[model samples]
Target: MSKAIDHLMKVHRPKQKIQNNRLRSVIVSIYLTKFVPCGDPANANGGRWLLTFGSPDMKLDDLWQETLLGMIGDCFSHDSDPQPLSRFITGCVVSIRVRGHKMGLWLSEAQNPNIVREIGRRWKSMMNLPSTIRIQFETHNESGSAQQKPIYEE
Candidate 1:
């Protein structure tokens, strides 16, 4: 994934008869001190909330914007908790796949299921995704070819 790439929202994909067939992934990495792959200390224990849109739509832009704004604008917080959930978030990504586009929100801790689940719940709301739409929470570590179960979902 590209680190700290700008204008990711503006990056257009090649026209396709079926929009879901798009191949290239658009990644937007948000970091605290440095890039993740470059050994950013902040992401040592990071994980991400992954949302896959089976069918891309006009709302995709709006959903992404809301997430980015929530992170940079410090608008995320759990009930009765003054700590901003964004503090744990490291970055996000939008990866295009043959069947759909995957949007991921990276967070700094994977061990805390409460925080992780809370973030997922907030993101589902932030994106206005209905109960029909389910998202996954997974660690940043690659599990190789083995399929790892989602740690949590919301």
Candidate 2:
């Protein structure tokens, strides 16, 4: 997406709404319809969303920008893996819910733990989070289903 489109679509949350911290129904609908696809892990796992819960002290947009900037930088990093997995990161989302805030990095697959972990590590580094900070990987199938739990986490 273009920066103009991104800026237009990017959420600008208010203080009150941030304090509420509830994932709005509109956002959920958008994720379900626009991002998450329908199918099996092998066929549809082409993309994954790396989800990280933000610290209570951090603002949603700040975390989003940090993680996003990190992803963007990695995309152009010079010292790189011969077969890079970061190429799969298509975009990101910063969500505020009643429980807390979350930043999701959208990837192109969920089957490879190596790629997933690498992405998670990059995300943690970018956000300046600790190693223990949990990052969850959820496939479109798992995310779309009401009963299934997330596919993986690191």
Candidate 3:
């Protein structure tokens, strides 16, 4: 009876470890998805827009650049009006959360124009904001009409 109990414990230990690892992986994946802005708006007004990339391993600025380029590409393909896209996206606030190996992003309306315009211009889309609004970036790079900057301030 003692020998049988020992064998069962040994078998269960490995299975438990595997289950724990799997759970950790799932948690990490969920975190990553949250960091990226991938979801439908609550009002069902516009199509899904995923702008933020939620991993600490990934740079938010670079992800913004890529997202802008991708959106521009999409616009080019669909030939949609750039003005409305600029207005809608500029008014959005994206929240990205990343901890250790996990990340997540959430998007909603933003009251600040600086935040909106900074993110909007990355897509080469223009925004009209009040003159009282102030915009700042830690790093700014411009190549032709393409501009890039970090979305979050350090």
Give the Cα-based TM-score of candidate 1 against the true structure: 0.75
List, residue by residue over 21-46, the lDDT tens digit for candidate 1. 44354444444445644256667677
Sum up the clashes in candidate 1.
Answer: 0
Flag clash pairs in model 1. none
Please tell me which predicted candidate would have the highest TM-score against the true structure.
1
lDDT of 2 by residue, 1-154 (tens): 3674475346454334444665242132122123433443333665454554555665555656565555645542336665665566656665556566556676666778777667766666667766677777777656656785666666
Model 3, total clashes: 6
TM-score for all models, in order of appearance: 0.75, 0.64, 0.22
lDDT of 3 by residue, 1-154 (tens): 5563454334322223436565432221111112233333331232212232333444443433334334333332223444343333311223333233211222232334444444444432322223333233221112112454434431
Question: What TM-score does candidate 3 reach?
Answer: 0.22
RMSD of each: 5.2, 5.0, 18.2
Stretch of 10 with least lDDT, candidate 1: 9-18
lDDT minimum window of 10 residues, candidate 3: 26-35
How well does model 3 score by local distance difference test?
A: 0.31
The candidate scoring highest on lDDT is: 1
Model 3 error, position 43 (Å): 6.3
- Put the candidates in TM-score order, highest first: 1, 2, 3
Which is superior by lDDT, 2 or 3?
Answer: 2
